[model samples]
Target: MEEKKIVSIEDRIPKLKEARKKKANRRLLFYLSIFFLLIAAIIYLQSPLSNIKHIEVTGNKIISDEEIIQLSGLSPETNIWVINHKQLKQSIEKNPLIKEIKVKRKLPQSVQIQISEHKIVGYVKSELEYHPVLESGMIINKHNISNKGDGPLLINFDDEEYLKRMAKELGEIPDHIFNLISEISWEPTEKNKYKVVLYMNDGFIVHATLRNFASKMKTYPSIIAQLDEGEKGIVHMGVGTYFEKLEK
Candidate 1:
């Protein structure tokens, strides 16, 4: 009886080893299958089949879609997953007029871009040309940047830098005050102060300087509230706030 039991134990041990080997082989095959599938997925995503097929651009009034595409160097042939977003932003920033921009990939082959442009509050004339002045008081590049409206034209000897500075502050100023401003001027004189010679559309001149523009201008809404229809003249904000006009 003991001999028979030993023979049976030997046979059972061999069967167990065979089962363990079979299980190990099955696990190895499963892992390898998953690995190959992952590689195939990666290749598909990187190929043209998953490349950028369309492009959408918005919030671009100053820049056109074609221009954005050209500036970003993005096209239908570009791969969405492989494209570098930082490179695209740097390319668009090349345009000095662009204040801010955004770029992104929209799955399965699409790219989108959004942009905001610099605001033009006023303009300055040079010899025979003009440059648009930004709200920040900086001049934007324009060969013949001219305004065609019923407002005061700035006649400044040193308008180049002022125009650039003015351009930078356009969006920061209140819209009503901006529209009320008819003209701005700068002189290359002893006090090269950025003086704002505002001419109201309603026949009044605003004596404002760019130094404390935001804080000083904040008092304007209240001042205009106290004015009468017949009241018209210069509102001096440079020093102590006051309003005056030439003897009629």
Candidate 2:
């Protein structure tokens, strides 16, 4: 067997140096990668690519998209990362017509606004124009009677309190029954100040008091079902529920 050769510490020193250099190179590459990533992040945040480029509004009827966007307090200059959704929603909901709203950020650079408006129950006539009345008791003067369909017509009822009560009662009734009502005239009597007459689209008249209009009118379908199909007249639920057939 050949004699075993002894390796000097000087020979191992070169290998140790090469290993240290490799470790340092790896560490330097890691730190450089981290530094470049941080710089890229800063650039992405400050660039116009991070700004809001699109704003979309939906579920608006009376209010226009431009009007809603103006109310939202959001502009093209706004940064998508710093949007306060709650504050923006509150601002848009300040309009009486907007019952609810939602704001969301789409990926890249876009914002979406969803709105739910109050239900328009009827219209009140003033001169030749008709103002739309919402379920929240607000009257929108933007529309006229000609622009509207056959909704309730309020006669001699201008009191906001009374109108609110009327609107509340009308809202409680089912849509099927509510749609049948063509006109409503508030005619207060000495005995009952809340008395009103409803003219149905089916050519039948409804006499009811605002006190229990919703409760009483709920039985309207059953009452009409019991009557003859050929018969048409007045349905009186003002005091006790009864029917009066009009003789030809």
* lDDT values for all models: 0.70, 0.85
Model 2 lDDT per residue over 1-248, tens place: 89999999999999999999999999999999999999998998899989999999988877788888988898989999999988998888877778989888898999999998777788888889777788867788753222343357677777888889998888788888888888899888899889999988888999999998899999998999999878999999977989998999
lDDT of 1 by residue, 1-248 (tens): 45553457777898999999999999999999999999999989767888788999887665667777788998878777778888888998777656788887788677889888666666666677656655555555642222242223566626456555554444566777767666666543467467766666767777777676767777787887788778777789886898785567
Cα RMSD for candidates in order:
4.6, 4.1
User: How far off is residue 198 in model 2, in Å?
Assistant: 0.4
Candidate whose TM-score is highest: 2
Assess every candidate by TM-score.
0.76, 0.81
Clashes of each: 23, 0
User: Number of the top candidate by lDDT?
Assistant: 2
Error of 1 at 92 (Å): 1.3
Clashing pairs in 2: none
Candidate 2 yields a Cα-based lDDT of: 0.85
